[model samples]
Target: MDAIEKNLLKEVAELDSLPVGAYNIRANGQLAGRNTTANIDIVTKTDKPGIDIYIRPFTKNESVHIPVILSQTGLKDLVYNDFHIGEGADVTIIAGCGIHNCGGGNAEHDGIHTFWLAKNAKLRYVEKHYGEGDGRGKQIMNPTTIVHLAEGAEMEMETTQIAGVDDTIRKTGGDLAEGASLVVKEKIMTTGDQHAVTDFNVDLNGEGCSANIVSRSVAKDESKQEFISHINGNCACAGHSECDAIIMDHASVIASPALTANSVDASLIHEAAIGKIAGEQLIKLMTLGLTEKEAEDQIVNGFLK
Candidate 1:
């Protein structure tokens, strides 16, 4: 492996040795690697960052993980991942993108993911984005996700963006059928002069369908972040969305959460709040012999965790 790939693998996957049933894709110019189980298949189209993943039916209690890394500097990469989860399946998906740039030009990664869950299926999807380097170039990431849930299907998606990304725009949407449910939790921490904008939308189109979304973020230094979430209930359904953020230094943030109900049996609600660390919490920790910096770190850790 080259030095850039090595750095990306270490910083992103946080492992020298890969785990069982793990699929790794190093997206420099095209789709370049793969390894997987019999129940799950991975295919890459002709020299593109687009990948198709198929999970066989009745593959209950199984888990699949795919980690994508971009180690090329002074370039732009567009990746599209399609996932098809079969009926009666219970699965957990761990997928994320990490980038390392060491050049002067711009380094950007745009990820587009679509998920299709069959009837009675349950899925827990987790994705985290991170970028790091000493280069003068900017590291920007744009992630777009769309999910479709069949009857009686349930999907819980969690997305996180750690430190070091310069700019990001995150967008996610969900469409739910009868007896279907979708839950999303997004966490982000931005430093320096980074900027992030996120938008989430959900349409509850079936009876007994439900959708819930929550966002947590911490902005430090001169960073700025904005979060917009909306949930629409077209049938007898329930929807909720909330945004919570911590603002530090000269950073700024905006949280806009809205919900609408068109059906008589629908119930929708939303809330948003932005604040900083309470001085009392820090003083309480200081009384336990921790320094101010240590106490601050502890609080950040707890909030993010």
Candidate 2:
């Protein structure tokens, strides 16, 4: 192996030896010094399951970027995983998981992620979770993500969840500091006999802090989806939250979006809607020579676009 490859393997071995809990990435040779910058790419073996990751700044003013990819081959249960982003540093992280297992057995996965954006820092995170059909009874996933922003810091987070075997529950939230801002967007799609729930909460704790949340979900067959979003302004902050869902063919959806402002100077607004696709649009597409299924698919594709 090359020098870099050997070093990386050594680091991974060291991390594997640590106890199961939160530990700084620096301890594993994944982090550079404070005020420096580093990039990390991770690809795990198929079906290995459990992994716990913690990211923290070695010193103030550091910057780090991480990209992670997961494959479904040899899939096993992922009991718990954690991600931590430290204060006073900028971090950009991208993560995605896909299941390609063809066996007919149930699976369960859970994850917890935390972000601490210090003063004058920033964080941008994007995550996609998807599962493939295996004719299994139940496949469950529960994920929770939390973010804390300090003065002048900002966070931008986006998530996409696509249904696979059975039921999935995902929860995410964050707190914004003075002059900080947070923007979150989520998209969910499900089919078959699946059940999914997504929850989001945002707190604006300092003056001039703001937040924006947008969520959309689509369910088909006997599937069910629920979306809940809340935005709270504790001091003098301003923000808005919007949620909408589309249901079809015996599918059901529930949407709840709320905005609360504790101080008079704070301004918050929220809106939520749940319904099916407009029949007129479908009919129009069908008249264009598309089959019923094709028209429906077109509408869904357009909605997500």
Candidate 3:
């Protein structure tokens, strides 16, 4: 890997070098490196431009890193990565994409990730998206995620996209079985003339199934953002979704949340809040000797964290 790729990896995945466990690195739409352990296997799909990851049953305390980087001009890369986790396994998956386009042509990467967790399995997934370049063209990313949790399974997801991307559309959906649970937290920031949209849909179809989804975002300058979430409880299930955003300058934010309950015992809730930073928050920080910009940055940082 070159210095640019290394820097991008550090920014997106916080990796100083190749990880110690199972991993795969993709750059410029091709495989750059790969390693698999005895309990986990990574295989490339012959019919697609992505890999399939398999974790054996009863495996625990292991992790996998699959990060993609793009440095080419006028390049559009699309990949489909699927994960199959065995029963009773507990593991973590780190995946993200970074792009550097320094030309007049646009650069884009679209990734679709699907996960299947067996009974009693637990998974922790993290994904980050970033873009950087001094170019006239745009940096665009569209990511879609699908999850399926079996009975007694659980999955927790953390996703963030803080800066540099010019345009993005993110979509996530999940289905939970009996006694299954799903939790998702997302953070995003947009500045300049950038635009971002997020959509989340979750279904709790079995008794005792539950889901919670939350998103926090900041829009600054002339940027625009939209968030839509839908939670459906079919059978004695519980679901909740929330969206919180801060708008600044001429930026605009729209949040739409929907909840549906088909069973009498099902419970669902949706909440959304969008507004500018409180003047008192800035004044309090300023009294502590911080500049106005610094105070605003600190507040936004803490809110997202």
Candidate 4:
């Protein structure tokens, strides 16, 4: 990997070197590196631009890293990756994309990831998106994720958009069976004239199933952000969605949450809060030898953390 690609990997996945266990690195729309363990397999698709990962049953304490980097000008890349986790397995997946465009044309990457979890399986997935360059070209990314959980399966997802993407749209959907659970937490920050939108749709389709989705964001300068979530409970289940954001310096944010309960025993709730930083917060921080901007940044960092 080149220096640019390595830097991108660090920023997106925090990998300073080749990681142990199963891993795949994609750079400039091509596979840069790959490794697979005995219990985990990674195979490239013959008909499309993507890979499929399979984990053996009863696997535990394993991880996979699949990070994508785009450092070319005027490049448009799209990929579809799918993961099949076996029964009674527990593992972690780290995936993300970073773009460094240095030309006068737009550079964009769109990725679609689907996950299937078998009965009694558990998965922890983390994904981050970042963009940077001193160029007139725009950096754009759109990611779509779909998840299916079997009986007693569980999944926890953490997604973050760190900085510098000019435009982004994120979509996540899930379906849960009996006794299954899904939890999604997202964080995003947009500045300048960037625009960001997130959409989440989840269905709790069996008894005792549950889904929780939460998002925290900061919109600065002329950036605009929108958060939309819809959760449906088809049986005796629980669902909750929350969106919290801080608006600053002509920025705008909108949050819309909807829930549908088809069974009498289903429980659903939604919450949203959008506001600016409190003056008292800045005053308190400033009294401790910090500038106004420093105080604001500190507060924002702590809030996002």
lDDT scores of the candidates, listed in order: 0.85, 0.64, 0.94, 0.95
In Å, residue 22's CA in model 3 sits off its true spot by 0.3
Instruction: Give the residue spans of candidate 2 off by over 4 A.
Output: 1-91
Candidate 1 clash total?
0
In model 3, which residue pairs have backbone atoms overlapping below 3 Å?
A: none
Ranking by lDDT: 4, 3, 1, 2
CA deviation > 4 Å runs, candidate 3: none
Give lDDT tens digits, candidate 1, residues 149-249. Answer: 99999999988888779999999988999999998988999999999999998899989999889888999999999999889999999998888898999
lDDT of 2 by residue, 1-305 (tens): 23433333233222223222222222111222122223222222245433333345533333332222122233344423334444555655554443333455554545566666667667777666655545643556677888888888888887777556367778888888899989888888889878888888888898999898888778899998888878888999988888877889999888877777788999998887788888898899999999989999888877765
What does the lDDT read for residue 149 in candidate 4?
97
- Which residue pairs clash within candidate 2? 47-74, 47-75
What does candidate 4 score on TM?
A: 0.99
- TM-score, one value per model: 0.95, 0.75, 0.99, 0.99
Off by over 4 Å in 1: 2-4, 46-48
Query: Which should have the higher lDDT, number 2 or number 4?
Result: 4
Error of 4 at 246 (Å): 0.4
Better of 1 and 4 by lDDT: 4
Q: What is the lDDT of residue 185 in candidate 4?
A: 93
